[model samples]
Target: MDPWVSLDPPMPAGARARAGEPGGARELVTGALADGTKRGDVGGHLELAAALGAVVPRPASGSTATLWESLATLGAHDLQLARAVEPHLDALAILDEAGVAVAAGPGATWGVFAAEGPGVRLVARPDGERWLLEGTKPWCSLASHLSHALVTAWVDDRTRGLFALDLRDPAVRTGEHAERWVPRGLPDVVSTPIEVEGAAVTPVGAPGWYLERDGFAWGGIGVAAVWYGGAVGLARRLAQPVGRELDQVAHLHLGAVDQHLTASRAVLAEAAAVVDSGGVTGSAAAALATRVRSVVVASAEGVLAACEHALGPGPQVGDASYAAALADLRLYLRQHHAERDLAALGRQAEHEGPWWTTRSAT
Candidate 1:
């Protein structure tokens, strides 16, 4: 059997180095990104964000969604920037803990640190005397930077294992992410596609060490919050113009839009509270994730509809800033969690026959 796994206590700690980070730096950087950065081309900057999140306080327990939220919000770009660094801590720390390699590159982007194929997933394999890695990855947030990748690939039969690869080595092909559907919101993100060519990697620990099992819940939080932030930004800009003269229909539509947005954000805050409370990986959590992703999508659409109704004329045509902001929000609205990730809860919850029957048999 292959020997690798997600961390029992997924994710790690000791990341809090960003406070000394440039004051308002996150705001400034995202502001610049609002208009200049093209959609799907900021791989370089996203790596920095992932690096920042990775360097700061990681979660004490892997299950806690707070850590993921913190990392995602370390800045608008953090999710993509400092994501890879999460896995390499042990890859390097184990060596340090064991008095071996003192230097290791941070695997800031976790997605890039993985490999997957057909039946098997994650890191684990027993190829004679060595394990072999093979698979393709998507949305490797820190693809552009970092020294190593923690990847998951097909192991034996249908099982998977998580493995770490030192990117500095010649066997591994580490580079940039490919063209993706989602863009604009995380322009600096360099999530790319990569291949491992008979790469030499070591098993850091055991099988299924966990790279955030409740990951959907965590992803939901960040995407929801970003929507809230974007709404706030859009509202702040619209407040003045909103007060201007408007048709009765437009006024009512605007008011309704505002109320919808406000309610959506309140729900988002509640979702955050749930994550903070450690309800991030259950039936309720999955349901909540679906709800939040849906709400954010609706909110973004409403905001645009309101804007178009109110300013779709000369003002909007002339104001490039307003148009650009709307475009950015639209990119994130395409937020998608594959059906496989969504169905995870049900798959695990199922009993061979029926739960009642199984219990009776027992």
Candidate 2:
């Protein structure tokens, strides 16, 4: 199946240049925001994500091949630019977390609410046969723009559940979001805290539905793919022709960067095939995500360092698009979780077994 079907079409001239600007990601879909309007070609971004079945990830509707394809495209373009897009993808992950899928309107957008830090404690209260969610949910990306969200909340002392929340509800408060989301990289991404009092919500699945499924790790690898793409984008700068003035040191740096990227790409390709074949959930998928994310993160960091050292400040200070990509990639790769993720990887390796195993000739 052709994974790029939706995204392969020509985009508006200079749209990408604009996308590198602050809060400019909205232009990816440009006129699609207007009600009842269909923007030429641009309208296909989401539809292609849906059609590729990567971000949505279900046997009945999506595929890993599609997901990787989309991630590579988005990552290479601008990692930060995808911030405006990933929340919608994450919304799908949340519903899939609950083993539920609901048809949404063409322009509908969704956000994920799983930030476990100081914020609102969402509690589910019984409202006759229905459920009401009360309290605040933090790290709600695109809260101001989304029509709905799949929120995680405490159903009781022992259970957590996934809820489909309509953002348009009068009980939902998104007014204070803008003041809270000031970040250097994805500053335009409005990941804010939202308070909902007595807001009605539909439970997508039974309790503990969001994290127990295979999609959890699958979604993680998708994020890694974005990072990988960003790394590729940075590496592309080094791929250009350097005049004879280029030194052996610069040539050596470029070669090392290429090796890292090539290795990481092979790992990513293998992991995608593993996920597509199934059975890569629970600890197994987690291991895969950590390994892939680590490799990609390392590659991106190494490439960034090598490029900065060899090319110096030319691209970063003078080239607007290149500078944005470099800055965005530096920030986006922080999703790696550093030591915490490395600990998880170590544990997985210990549990899996000895790395070197010799077998008798068949």
Candidate 3:
């Protein structure tokens, strides 16, 4: 995979050999989270990455090199789970549990698994102290290999629940969703739909992890990173061979995206810092974080649009590569989270700290 060629780089080598050291997509995510945990409370993974690199920085370790290659894991679903592990998580980077019970439980081990849509349903009930789950989930990004899945289920049909189910058990069936498997965006991204009937599960923590709590909104990071990567690829593809328009737009496009990326970094850093220091659970800093993401996504869209104009009609239209990336990214743009997440940012804006608050003095 050539980032210049396909806006995606080739997958790294030797998963079998690297089995113990930061191997697989989940490990990569775990490594990244571990890195962020060392730094602060950031949730937007890329921003956390940037903050790690640009702000606090990660400990120099060989594992990080693998972590860098693991970035490609997000793109893995496009190539099936095995090929998708590296530098990106098959582009399924966004993972948010509606509640703590869902986000932080045992099945949270499968937090690396990105569901097809954010509309993942979880069904949890009390069977003594342990909870049991039964429901269908589509778009389990790494479901092929993911042994656990963190989900938000319904409680008593009135409220919802979050559960972490161990997919390792034969009782918990794991396979691609035969009924519906194709997604308009991220094709080859086998977000396998899942159906768990009476699957043995466990409760992660309490109810706080599963709800639309503070940290829930922090999920924009991975999605933003993948989309950003796609935008970079598109813009790179459209980069003018020697033209006035595409070439000029490329510089402007990068500049605009840089501002958003920078601000987003700052916001995420603050959010992470707040969480790290125990200043807030999640929402204390989500407003600015979401705002930064909004800008980043908007600028990324501009980059895509400029790519279209730069490459001209015939090339982009005729080329299979452009069509593929465009289709996938376009679908992401339409998802419930993209727009709704921004709406979330807007809704929370009123309650943010002084940094994001309206200035009456001005």
Candidate 4:
């Protein structure tokens, strides 16, 4: 039997081949995980990413569907692996956007440490012809393992800049407060604090360019794609056949899961098209991301609830994959920002005319 149903629409035979069809991401990840490679092994995950380099298309490269599908495939197999690889891909995309040449050396893994927290600040200052970063950065996932990172730091009180730095630099310290990241979901993917003192860095783009670029929105939607995939992985448990036939109640839950996943997949596909077409720019891209993320988050949450209702505690305890997927997805979906993002979308939608109007109605 197939691992999971394909959430994407049909594509041309040649396009499918280019999009990592046949034994692509699914085979690579499945084979790796089966070979005693732990999900939390950051080094092993980086090797997987390197192996998948040929297949995983970069976002907005006219094969956005392919890129997302590959990510979904990873998430389906293991969310921790997906979590480890997604930021590396995003960092490469960001560097490409800023016209920086990516010298991806052997085993060179990258991450984006852009999250800011209260009372913790990383500052960047001019150092002759180069830039140096000081202070601390929070939410640096897999920091100890990653060789490079794109860090966002305050250049001034009102300005923040994005800089690429070598994590191996002696001035950079990771795993501060290491004991604080005790979570059930994604326990292997530890996100800790890092401290850097006068670490030499390379500026990727102008101040504020990271958030202003259209890729920022595109990256956000990419994360939603992973969430959708993780939910799909969880929902697959419902499809497994036991010795006896499933009753009507089980069937009902499966149907609902299908509905939610299908909707989420549709929006992601639509957003990918918009991004590749370059039809939306500036704030429009942000709006598109907000809308896509909102739809995916709701669908993922609904699927999560339905899976728990349908499968009950048997799979939760009996199936390691199912249980880990459940926890990882629940934690991963929290990245959506919940009500705050919805409120922002609401503010944007208020000025638009009607929400329910169809093209035929117009």
Top-scoring candidate (lDDT) = 4
**Best first by TM-score, ranked:** 4, 2, 3, 1
User: Predicted candidate 2: what Cα RMSD to the true structure?
Assistant: 8.2
Write model 1 residue lDDT over 161-199, tens digit each, in one string.
556666566665555435553455445544655555676
**lDDT tens digits, residue span 127-158, model 2:** 89999999988777667766788888898888
- Please tell me which model should have the higher TM-score, number 2 or number 4: 4
lDDT of each: 0.49, 0.67, 0.46, 0.83
Clashing pairs in 2: 54-67, 120-136
lDDT string for model 3 (1-362, tens) is 32311112224674233234332434444455344332112124333232222221111222322332333233222212212332122112212222223233321224343243566665677888777777766556546555455655666656665565666766566665544766655554445666777876655446544445443443444344444445555555554343445356556755654454344334433433443354544464456346646655676667667656555676655766567666666765553356887778666765554555455664
**Candidate 4 to truth, TM:** 0.91
Report the C-alpha displacement of residue 13, candidate 4, in angstroms. 14
316 Cα displacement, candidate 3 (Å): 2.7
Clashes of each: 54, 2, 50, 0
Candidate 1: where are CA atoms >4 Å away?
1-51, 54-124, 127-132, 138-142, 145-150, 174-191, 202-212, 241-253, 279-281, 313-321, 337-362
